[model samples]
Target chain A: MTPEEEAQLKRARRGRNIALALVLIGFVALFYAITIVKMVD
Target chain B: MTASANPALPAEWRDFFALTKPRVMSLVVFTGLCGLLAAPGTIHSVLGFTAVLCIALGAGGAGALNMWWEADIDAQMKRTAKRPLPQGRMKRTDARDFGVALSVASVLLMGIAVNWLAAAVLAGSILYYAVIYTIWLKPRTPQNIVIGGGAGAFPPLIGWVAVTGEITLMPVLLFALIFTWTPPHFWALALFVKSDYAKAGIPMLPVVAGEAATRKQILAYSVVLLVVSLAPWWIGGTGPIYGVAALALSGAFLALAIPVALRRAVEGDAMKPEKRLFSFSVFYLFALFAALVADRLILGQGALS
Candidate 1:
């Protein structure tokens, strides 16, 4: 692949990683809230 | 325009996200949340959130798959030409895989996390939009939106079932309200974008039946929608607040539809009334659902179960 194509791939990968991290964080927060609610109940 | 055939085309995160049709997902999520909130029972907030999340994801997945199947048709129309698949920013196979994965994951998660009934409806809805509507009905008949309305109506019903664990009158009413509301709402849009459908070779109402016939049908559907929208309150399923809001909103809906129905075309822009009614229809659904939740919260136990 050309250098520009390689750079594009890298940028795409970085963006995907950030999106994945945000989703994971959201899941953790949701699960934590569920646990707190379950404990209180 | 030739879709990029390059195997090396790196799909951006935004392109993948666009495949989900996030704008459409927002409405799905909102209606689902409203249904959850309006239901009689209280759920663990986490599970409630999860149910809405699943609804959003399921709707998104279905939308992605619809775009995948309709990519060629979308390419033909100016309105949809800029979509990720049509633009060739993402491969069709990648979109199909992403859609399938999300659909399966959402349904399974819903079943494990919430209840089977909600999950079942979610699965059904995903297939209904992706397969029945997108692949089958849309190209074949002008009645596509009329029947396909059921798919969009599912989120609220699923949300209700997620909380109540069974189908009931109120949720059924919610479903019917949207189902009935859709023909008028979408037909109004078709009136404006008739040329787009013609170019795409999709048999939308205006293209098949002509603009006058489409306008009359819109009026008829709008009338039915108005009556159905008020059913929740009349049946004692919701409180006075919702009843009042439904009355006012449906009044506005009918008022807007009247001009579009009577006038052959607007003087300045033929699409003006159609556009007005179309915009108001979205707000109408949101406001009506919001009122349902508001009534339930404010009236406490006095609100009907």
Candidate 2:
């Protein structure tokens, strides 16, 4: 692969940690917010 | 000239207007507007307009920066090769600079016109998509769109905060609906655009996960999305009318997702289901939010303005 392609794939890889973090955060809302999950509140 | 043949560039000067990712902006507008409308407190008409303006500007700014950062990879991908920057009609530096300007200006305007909270969320979203997601995640990970999707989901929540000056369950439901909807929505496109994303060296889910895993994930997310979409009505954020409508729409969304989820691309299969899901996902979010807004309108919920 060219430098551009290498850089591209490498760049795409950096998002995994962020994605995991965000997904974990969202998942936390599911478990914790279950009691108070009022839609109109 | 390339501009002549391009569909977005009309004969009139106004034709250039559509290229700013107007369809996406309209979604931002509608969601933000719904957030403001659904809020219990009063926001002045002008402030509400300013809030919507901020969402549009912020969303557009992020899109521009996204285009600027991805120009090289976009040029390689068939799906995005024809975007303005990659097409050579627009200067790369110009896009970057313009994106920076709009992003900063929108944040500032929102802070001045609405609560600082909305502006902060808008700023964070812009940075999330432009720098964190685009510059960091997109080229590197299979999960890029999953994380970056939050950038698109912020508009309604921000708008709700803009009007009410606080985050609440209803707005959070709106936020969750969009957040959960993102993966299945983009994964559908990734199924067919697998080649384009791979050729661009981007690790989209279909490219990274393989088709079966991608399909399973799509179905999983769609189911979650359907459940979350109904939360507003279930929790009293909206009435049964909106709930029933959302259930119906999401049933259709699931119907589209299940086939793709079950099918393997290795067989003699066309990419129609992915395409169909992609098309319906567009309508799914729009109409779901529209139903919410319409519910408020019918219930004699006072207008935001």
Candidate 3:
């Protein structure tokens, strides 16, 4: 692969990893909140 | 610089996001929120947010699946050639898997967090759009949009059921409103983009039935849309706020539709009336649904019986 193509692929992988991390964190937080609400109700 | 130019490079996160059809999701989210708000009941703000989120996620999943399924057709069409799958930015398998994951997660989370009925309806809407409309109807029939309109009509019903925990007449009227409105709205677009659909080999009404027949169908659907839009008010479900808004909005809709219906397009014609009707139709639905929620919240109308 060309150096530029490799660099671009690296950037895309990094961006996807960060987005996946954020989504996982958000999912966990949402489930926790839902559980608390259910218990209180 | 385009993703298609470098196949070895992985697609950026934004490409996956684009698969969700975010612009369309915005309308789905809005109508779902309106239905939840207009329903005569109270829900915790968090649960309300969760319900809307599930609706948005379900829509996103369905859209992703649609792109995955139609990638070949999309590549052939000018309007959809730039999509991630069509442009070679994402693998079809990745899109299909992403769609399945989102669809499953949304339904499960809805059932766990909200109610089973809402979750089941959400699942059904996904299947309706992805399987029934995309796979079965779109390629085979010119009447595809007519039957497929039911898929988009479910959001308000699901949202209402989320709150009220039962199907009711008011939500059914909302469903009917969208179901009737889709043909005119879609066919106006089809008239203008007839060449693109024809190139893709999709049997859109304008492509299969000819422009005159499609325009007449648009007018007929608009007439039906007028009655359906006003049904909530006529049934005493909403107050004069929504009733008056429906009258004004649908009146304008029919007025714009008339010129598009009556005039035949000549060679080199701009299709201005058809374009105008398409734009107004989107605004009409948004405004009509917004008025429904306003009638409930501002006028303090009780829940529909």
Best by DockQ: 3
- Candidate 3 has a DockQ of 0.73
Question: Candidate 2: misplaced stretches above 4 Å?
Answer: A1-41, B1-19, B266-268
- Looking at model 3 chain B, report the run of 10 residues with the lowest lDDT sum: B1-10
lDDT of 3 at B263: 95
Give the runs in model 3 whose Cα sits over 4 Å from its true position. B1-4, B301-305
The residue-level lDDT of candidate 1 at B54 comes to 93
Candidate 3 has which clashing residue pairs, if any?
Answer: none
Task: Summarize candidate 2's per-residue lDDT along B1-305 as a digit string, tens digits.
Answer: 53333333212212223234777898889888888887777776667777888899888888888887887887887767767667765456767776888799889878866779889888998999889998988778898888877877888898889888887898888888899999999989888768777777888888887888999999999899889999888888788768889999999999999998988776656788899999999988888888887887787566564
Q: For each candidate, what TM-score against the reference?
A: 0.93, 0.81, 0.97
The TM-score ranking, best first, is 3, 1, 2
The model with the greater DockQ, 1 or 3, is 3
Q: Point out the worst 10-residue segment of candidate 2 chain B by lDDT.
A: B9-18
True contacts kept of each: 0.77, 0.00, 0.73
Looking at model 1, residue A28 earns an lDDT score of 82
The DockQ for candidate 1, computed on C-alphas, is: 0.59
lDDT of each: 0.88, 0.78, 0.91
Tell me the docking grade of candidate 2: incorrect
Residues B1-305, candidate 1, lDDT per residue (tens digit)?
A: 22233445668788888989888888899999989988888787778988899999999899889988999999999989989887778778999999998999899879977899999999999999999999988889999999889998998899989999999898999999999998999999888778898988899988899889988998998899889999999999888999999999999999999999997865557578889999999999999999999998897442122
The chain B TM-scores of all candidates, as shown, are 0.95, 0.91, 0.97
Arranged by DockQ with the best first, the candidates are 3, 1, 2
Which of candidates 1 and 3 reaches a greater lDDT?
3
